[model samples]
Target: MSRLLLSTLVVVVVIVVVVVVVVVVVGVVGVGVVVVVKVVAAAVVEENDYVWKNGNHAEKTYLFLVTNTLT
Candidate 1:
């Protein structure tokens, strides 16, 4: 009976650890995506002279700017 209980406890501890790890990884990735989106938006705003009404392809615009700067 004690061995059975020990096995059950180990399983529960492992499940809890897995859950915590998944949550932490997902949270970090989520924050990183948000930061990247905000940075791109800010760059677009600057390129448009602080106006956010440009109908152009901002992602391509930024890519072009980066490509130009690299070469």
Candidate 2:
């Protein structure tokens, strides 16, 4: 009976550890994705400034509105 109890306890502990590790890994990955997205968006905006400036007034206004909403 004691051996059975020990094995059950070990299993529970192992499951808990695995869950915690997975949560931590997912959290790190989520942050990394956000950082990468922000970096890519910034790069695109920098490279497209002239394109935006050359667009019509209505297009420029819509672009600014979208960019403002995002930030």
Each model's total of backbone clashes: 0, 0
In terms of lDDT, model 2 sits at 0.90
Off by over 4 Å in 2: 54-71
- TM-score between model 2 and native: 0.65
- Give each model's whole-structure lDDT: 0.82, 0.90
At residue 6, give the lDDT of candidate 1: 100
Q: Model 2 Cα displacement at 6 (Å)?
A: 1.0
Judged by lDDT against the true structure, how good is candidate 1? 0.82
**Model 2 lDDT per residue over 1-71, tens place:** 99999999999999999999999999999999999999998997875696597878887888789879988
- For model 1, how does the per-residue alpha-carbon lDDT over 1-71 read when each residue is reduced to its tens digit? 99999999999999999999999999999999999999998886586563334435785677568757976
Error of 2 at 60 (Å): 9.8
**How many backbone clashes can be found in candidate 1?**
0
Error of 2 at 26 (Å): 1.4
